[model samples]
Target chain A: MKRKFFSDRDKLEPALITIFAGVFSVLVGVGLIFIVSKDPVQSVRNFLLGPLLRTYNFYYLLIAMVPITFTGLALCIIYQLKYTSLIVDSSFYSGAIVATAIGINVSLPPGLHPAIAMLAAGLVGGLISLLPAILKIKWRANELVSSLMFNYVFYFIGSFVILYYLRDRNQTILASMPFQKSFSLPKLVENTQLHAGFIIAAVFVVLVSIFLFRTRWGYEIRITGANPKFAAYAGIPVATVALYAHFVSGFIGGIGGAVEMSGLYRAFIWQMNPSYAWDGVIVAMLARKNPKFVPLSALFLAYLRVGADFMSRRGDVAFEFITLLQGLIILILASDKIANYFKERRLKRAALSHDLAAQASSAGGQP
Target chain B: MIKFIISVFSSSNYWFIVLRSTAPILLVTLGAVITEQAGIKNMALEGSMLWAALTGVIVSAATGNVWAGFIAGIAAAVVIALILGLFALKLDANAVLCGVALNLFSTGGTVFVLFSLTGDKGISSSLASKTLPFIKIPFVENIPWVGKIFSGQNIIVWISVLAVVVIHIMLNKARVGVRIRAVGENLEAAKSAGISPNRIKFLTLAVSGVLAGMAGCFLSMGYTSNFTSGISAGRGYVANAAQVVAGGTAVGAIFASLIFGLTDAMATYLQNIGLPPELIQALPYVVTILGFVVITLIRDRKELIRKKKLFEKDRAKPLASGLGA
Candidate 1:
C-alpha cells in the first residue's frame, strides 16, 4: 500500500497537538471556573498570573515539581526502553511507602538522612516494579495488569505499616512519625520551601537523559521495545532489559516519592498521597515519554496543580474543576487516532486548494 | 478437639460474613467477566459503582423506595457506561486509559455534585440513606442442611445467586452468549460470521454497567445506606482479579468472589477483635496478591501437565504416521 500524504509529519503532529492541547486545556479550565464563580475574568487572571508573583508560592511550585520531576524521569526511562502500558504510577506509591518506612523507623544523622531514606525508597520501589517483570517473564502475565494489581498490595502494606507501627500517637490525626534530621532532605534556601531535593531531581533528570540517549544499555532497551523478536535474534536478552527497565523506572519513582515526603511533608500524611503516579503518567505522556522533556512536563503539571490550588482558595471556583480539565486532556490524548484523522483531512483540503489556485492562475495567463 | 470446634464454629461466622461480603465483589466479577469477554476491559466498574451508589441514594431518598433506587442506579451506571463506550468504541480512545479517565471523573464528578446538592465534601443524604430489607425464607428455615444457607438474606444476595446461574446458562447455552464469547475470543472471526464486534462490545459493556450498578445498589442501599466519595474502594479491581482467576466462568467467579469476601471479612473481623485496624484492612489486598500468585502457579502447572500429555501423544502419533507410510 502506498503511503498517504502527511504520513511523514505524523510524529510532528502529536507535538503540535500537545502544545495546542495544553493551551486549550487552560482555556477550558478557566471557562469552567468562570461558570461557577461570578467574576470569570478575575478568576482566570488570578489562576494564570497569580502564583508566579508570590515568592513563597513560587518556591512551593518548584517544590511540588520535585516529585513530578522524578516521576517523569522514571516514566521516560521506561518509555525509552520501549515498554508500553506505562506501569510506573503504582511504582511511585510503592516507592513512597519505602521512603516513609525509613523516615518513620531509622534515626540517621542530618547530612546522610535524606540520601539514605531516598536510597531505601528507591530499592523498595524497584523491588515492587519487579513483580510485573517476573510475572511477565515466568507466566506471560500482562505487565499492565500485574503492576496495577500490585499497586493495591503496596497500598495495603504501606497503610498497614504506617497505621500500626509507625503512626504518631502524639498527634490525633492519622499520620506516621516524623523523620529524624538525618533522613530529611537538606534545606537550601533558608526560609524558602525549595529544598536540596529539587537539586537532586534536576541532577537525576540530566543523568536520565544521558542514560537514555547516549548509553549502550539505552540502545538495547530501544531495540527490544521496537521488536522483541528481532532484538532476541540479534542476541539481546529481551526479558532482562524488560526487567531492568522496570527496575530503573521504579527506582526513580521511589526516589520521587521519598523526595516529596522528606522535602515537603513532615511525615507520611495519609494512607495515600497525591496521585503523583497519575501525574507522572500524564507528564510522561505529554512529553511523549521523552527523557529530555520530563523536567519541563513535570514542572508544567506541578504548576497546574499549584495554580489550581491557588485559584480554588482565592477564587470562587472549586478545585474539582482542575480534575475535569485533566480528564479532558486525557480523553484527547488517548484519542490520538482521532487527532490524526483530523490532521489528514485538513492536509488534503490544503492540497486541493493549492491545486485549484495554480490551475486558475495558469488559465488567466493563457487568456 | 475443643479448640478445633471453637475455631470451626467461631470461624463459621467468618464463613457467613464471607458470603455476605462477597455479594458486591461477585456482582462486580460478573460485570467484569462479560466486558472482558467482549474484548473490552472495563476499568470503569469502580466509577460505575460509585455513580450508581450516588444515584441510588438520590432516587431512594426522593421516592422512599429501595427498588426505585436500584433501578435508578442501573440507569445511571448505564449512562456513564454509554459515555465511556462512546469515547472508547466510537472515538477510538484507548479503553484502559479511558477507564482510568472515567475513574478520575467519577471521583471528581461525584464530589462536585455532592457539594452542589448537599454542601457535603464526600457523602450525601445522611438522613435519606436507607438499607434494603433482608428477606427471611418462609419455609426453607425448616430444611436441615440447606436452612443455614437459605434464611435471612437481602434480596440482592438472592439476585446475585440468580445472576450467576443466568449468566452461566446464557454464556454456555444461549446463542447471544456464544456470539458475545466469539466477539471476545476472536473479533475477526465473529465479524466474518456477521456479528458486529463494536455493537457486541458496546452491549456487553452496557450489561456490565447494569451488573455493576446492581453491585453499587448492594453497597449503598443494601447495606451501608450511604454514599462516600469512593465507596467502591477498589472492589472493581478486585472483581477484575476474580474474573481472571475464574477464567471468565460464572461459577468460578462466584467462588473467587467468596474467597475475596472471606479475605475482606477476615480483615474486618480481625479489626473488630481489637487487632490493628489497618493490618486487618490490609488482609484482602494481601490475599489478592496471594490469589494472583496461586492462580498463575496453578495455570503454569496445568500447562506443564498438558505439555507432557502432548509429548506422550506425539510419541504415539509418530509410530501411527510411520505405519501409514
Candidate 2:
C-alpha cells in the first residue's frame, strides 16, 4: 500500500535536498583542507572525525548544541507561519540581558530563580519580536527589513544596558556583574560547561513539537499559514495567529539565550552578537522546518562547529573555514532547480525500470 | 539640550563629517536601488563590499600598484554578483538566500584567506598597502563657509556625487533601464516583448556589484590607510533600508543616505555629552526604522485615498473589491 516513498514530492523533496547539500558541503570541506593543510590526509581525517575523537571534544560539541536547539526550534515556528522576521538574534541576546539583570538584582530560591529569569527572558524576547509583526499588520511594512533594523536597535540597546548599568567595574572586560549563586544552572558534567540547559532545550523540543502538531492553536496556525484569506474566511483571527507565532518564536529564542547565559556564563559577556539568529536559520533549513528534527540538525551543525575547532587546533586549518561550507550548503539547499533535477532523475529511473519489467513479462509469456 | 544641538549644527566640521560618512553608504544605497528596480533583492551587497574591500587591499599590496588593487576589487565584487546571478537565474535559487549564503562565505572566506596570507585575521598590516588621495576643490577651497563643508573631501566622495548624476540619467533615459524596469514590473510581459529577464537582472546585478566595489574600495583605500577586517561594518545592510526610504530612485538615495549621515554626525557630536556610546551607535538604525514605518504609513494613506477617488468616479459601476487593498 505504501510502496512509493515519494508518493508526495513535498515529503521526499526536502530529504533529498538535505542529503545533496550534506554531500556537497563535505566535498567542499575536503577540498578546503587540501588547499590549506600541510598534511592533507591527517587534516581530512580530523576534519571528518574530530568531534567524536575524544570525550573533551564530544562534550564541547554537545555544549554548542544547547543554545542553537532553542533558536532552531524558534525559527521553525516563525518560518512555518510564513514570516521572514529575523528577530532571533535580538530576542536571544535580549533574553540573555534580561536574565542577567534578574540574576544580579532579584533574589529568589534556587529552583524558582532560574525559572523566573527564563520567563522574563521569554517575555522580553516575545515583546521585541512582536514589534515588526505589529508594524507589518497595522502599517503594511516589510517584516524582513523592519526586523533587520530591530536587530541593530536591540543590539545597541543590549550594549548600552550592559555597558552603562550592568557593567562591573571590577571586571577587566566589558561584562555585567556576576549573577547570584542560586541563579546558576547546575552543570551536568565535571570540568565542562555542559549544564542542565541541554536538558531544558531537549524538553523544549518536545514541547514545541506538541504545541505544533497536537494542539488546537497549532491547527489554526497551520491553516492560516496554508492560506491567510481562507483562514480569515474560516473565522480564524489571522493577525492574532501571526503575532503569537512571532512572539512564541522570540519567546523560545529568548529562553535559549537565557539558558546559555544562566548555564555557562556567570555574567553577561557577549559584547558582540553571538549570532544564533543566522545559525538558527541554517539549522531550521537543514531540519526542513520540522521541530522533531531540530535537535539532530542542531547537533549536526554543532558537530561542524566543534569539528572546525578541533581541526583548527590539530589539523592546522583555521576554524572560520566552516562558514564557507555553511554558505555552500545553504546555496544548494535553497536552490529549487537542483531539487527538481534530482526528482526528475528519480522519475526517469522509475520509468526505465517499469519498461524493462514489461518487456521481461512479454518475453516470458508466463501470464 | 537645545543649545547643544544648535552649537553642534553651527560648526562647518559637522556638515563635512556628514558628507564624508554619506559617501560609502550612498554608494551602497545606490547599489541596492538598481537591483531592487530590476526585480532582484540584492542582499548580496554586503558580501560584495566585504570581498571587494578585502581583495582590493590584498591585490594592491601584492601588485605594488593602487590602480590594480582598485580594478581588482571591482572584479571581485562583479564575480560574486555573477555567481549569485548564475545560481539564482539559472538554477532557480532564492536570490535572498543566495545573498545570505554568499555573505556567510565572504565572512569566512576573507578571514581564512587573510590569515593564510598575512597570518593576521584582523588587519593586513604587513603588506605595503596604499591609500587613495583626497581632492581639494581649487576655487571652492578658497570660499569662506562652503569650502570647509565641500572641499578637501575624499576623491570617492566626489565620485559618489557624480555617480548620482550618472545613475539618474541611466535609469530615466537609457533603453537598458527601460528593459530592466519592464522585466522587474512584469517578467512574462518582458519575455513576451523579447527581453530576457535573466539578462537584464544579470546586467543590473553587475552594476550593483560595481557600486559595491567602489564603496568597498573607498572604505579600505580611501577612508582608511589599510584593509581592516569588517571595515564595511553592516553598511551594505543599512543600505537596503535606505533603498526602501529612497523610493527606488537615484536622487532619492541621496536624501535617504543624508538622513543616515545626519544621524551618524549627531551621534559623533553627542559623545561629549557623555551619552552611552552604545546608544549613540544605535540611534541611526532606530531612526531608519522609524523613517521606514512613517514612509510606509504615508504611502498606505495615499493609496487608500486614490482607491476611494476611483470608487467615487465609478459610482454607477460595481465597486471593485481591490478598493480595500
Candidate 3:
C-alpha cells in the first residue's frame, strides 16, 4: 500500500487557489504602496484598518455591497448560460434612466410608485439586452463586441434624455429632476444610513440560487450551456434558453441600477456609465459564477473599495490601487494552469486507485 | 441634403479630415490582421493604445524629443503585448477575460500615474509635449486640387499608408508570413514541420503592439497636442470591427478603416448642421454594428452556397461511379 501525499477526494483545491491569488494580490498592492508612499507603514495601516475604525465606514461598506451583489448575481446567471454578454453596462444605464423617468413623472401611491419605477427599469434593461441576444442568435455576431459597442450607444442616449428632456431647469448641472421624497427607499436601520436595497439584494441572491438549481428552465439552460448540440438533439430549444438567460440577467442588472440610484441619491445625476457593470464582472469571476457565493464575493469587493476609499482620504495612496489589485487577481485566478493544477493531479490519482481496485476485484472473482 | 453631399465631396479639407481619422484605425486594424493571422485574438489593443499615448506624452515632455517619445510609446505597448501573450499562451487564461482586465487596469493605472507625476487626473496639459511634425511634399504641393488632399499632413499619415503596402507584401510574399499562416491554419501540422506555434504567436503580437503604438502616437502627438485621459476612445474597438469586416486581409482592412473614418468624419460634419450632438456622437458605433451585421449576413450566404454545392457533388458521385462500372 502507498501513502498518498494529499487526499484525491478534496474538492476545495480551486477555492484554495483563488484564496492564494487574493492574498498574493494584496501583498503586491502593499509593495506598490511602499514604493509610492513616503510614509509606507502608515499607508498600509490605513489601507488595512481604515474601514474597521468607525461604524460609519462599516455602513458605507454595506451600502457599497448592495449594487455589487445584484450585478454579481446578474453576471452569474449570464455566465451559467455560457455567454460573455457585456451588455450589462448598457442595461444598467438604461435601467437608471427609466427608473428616474418613472420616479419623476409618474405620480402614484407611495409604495406603488417605487415598485412601478423598478419594474419599468427591469423592462427597459431586458429590451436593451434582447438586441444583442437576437443579433447573436440570428447572425452569429460576436456578443462581446456588439454588447461593448452598444454601451456607447446607450450612454449617449441616456445623456440625451437627461440633458434634453428631463433637465431640472433651475439646476446648473445636467441632471434629471429629483424624485419625490415619498419614492425614496425606506431606511433599514434607525441610526445608520442603511437602506432597503441591501435587503433586496440579499433576497435576490437567494432567489437566483433557487432559480439556478431547482427550476426546470434552469436545468434546460444548464444542459444547453454544457452541450448545445446534445440539448438540441434532445429537443431543447437552445436559442430560446440562451435568450431568456440574457433577459433575466439584464432584468436583475436593471433592478440593481434602480435600487442603487433610488437608495443612494436624490436625483439621476450620473453623467457617464458608473461602471458598476464592470465591477460586477470582477465579482462574478471571483465567485466562479456561483450564485450562492455571489454575496460573499460582492462583500469582499465592496470591502476593498471602501478600504481603498478610506486610504485615499487619509493617505497618499490613490483609490485606483484597488483596480490594479483586481486586475492582478483576475489574471491569476483565471489562469487555468494555476487554479486547475491540483485538481488535475487529484483526478489522476483517483483514476489510478479505481484501476487498482478493479484489477483486485476481477482477480478475486476469477479465483 | 444634396448640397451638403456635394459640399462634402468637393471640400479637400473634408477628405483630409477623413484621411487623418483613417490613419489610426488603419494602423490598428493592420495590427489586428497580423495577430488574427497568427491565430491569436489580441483584444488588448485599447489598453495598449492608452498606455502608449501616456508614455508618448510623458517621454516627449521629459526629453523634449518627439522621436524619443515615439520609441518610448512603442516600447510601452510592446511590453503590454508581451505580458498579454505570457498570460494567454503560457498560463492558458481566457484571452477575452484577460483583455478586459488589462483594459480596466490600463485605464486606472494611467490615471494613477498621471496624478502621481503631475497632480492632475484629467489631462497632461502641464507637460510641454511637442507634436509630431507635418510634412508638406515640395513637388506634390504645387498641384492644384490634389495638393490640398495630400500635402501638409502628419508624417505618421504617410507612414501609415506605407505600412499598408508593406504589410500587404509581407503577408503575400514573405516566408515568415507563410509560416504564421501555417501555424494559424493548423497548429499540429506546423508543429510536425518543426515550427513553434507559440513563438510565431508571440512575434505576431509584438508586431501588432508596435502598430497599436503608432496609432497611439498619432492620437496624442498627431491628432492632438497633449495626452488626455480616455484619449484612445473607441477607436481600438472600431479597428476590431474593421479588421473583422476585412476578413483579416491587409488591403481590405485599409478599405474597411476608410469606411469607418468616413462615418466618423460625417458625424463631426453633422454636428455643425444643428443635429443633436449626442446622436451625432453615436453615429460611428451605429455604423459599425450595421456594418458587422451586413458582413455576417454576406458570409452566411456564401457558406450556405458552398454547402449546397458540396451536397450536389455528393449526390452526383454515385451515379457517375455506376455509369463508369
Give DockQ per model, in order. Answer: 0.42, 0.69, 0.63
Question: Could you tell me every candidate's TM-score relative to the true structure?
Answer: 0.88, 0.94, 0.94
Worst 10 residues of 3 chain B by lDDT: B316-325
Report lDDT per candidate.
Answer: 0.77, 0.87, 0.84
Which residue pairs show backbone clashes in model 2?
Answer: none
Off by over 4 Å in 3: A1-10, A345-367, B319-325
Tens digit of per-residue lDDT, candidate 1, span B1-325: 5764456446545655666788889988998888888888888888899889988888888888878988999998887787788889988887777777787777777776665567676677553856778888978867654556556667788888988998888788888899999999898899999999989888888988999999988888766768877789888877777777777889989878877887687676556557777666667866765676678789889988987777777678755333121
Cα lDDT of model 2 by residue, B1-325, tens digit: 9999899898899999999889998998998999899999888888899889888898889898988998899899988888899889999987877887888888888888887677787888887887767888999998988999999888889999998888888898999889989988999999999999999999999999999999998888888877777677878878888988888899999998998899998999898798878899899999888887887788889988987888786775765454443
Looking at candidate 3, what is the lDDT of residue B203? 94
Candidate 1 lDDT at B269 equals 55
With a 3 Å backbone cut-off (N, CA, C), the pairs that clash in candidate 3 are none
Please tell me which model should have the higher lDDT, number 1 or number 3. 3
Q: CAPRI band of model 3?
A: medium
TM-score between candidate 2 and the true structure = 0.94
Regions of model 1 farther than 4 Å from truth: A1-8, A34-45, A79-91, A100-109, A315-317, A342-367, B1-15, B63-65, B140-150, B307-325
True lDDT of residue A254, candidate 1? 84
Indicate which candidate wins on lDDT.
2
Off by over 4 Å in 2: A1-13, A314-316, A346-367, B316-325
Model 3 lDDT tens row, A129-189: 8888888899988787788888888899888888888889998877789998867888898
* Model 2 lDDT tens row, A280-313: 8888889877899999889889988888888888
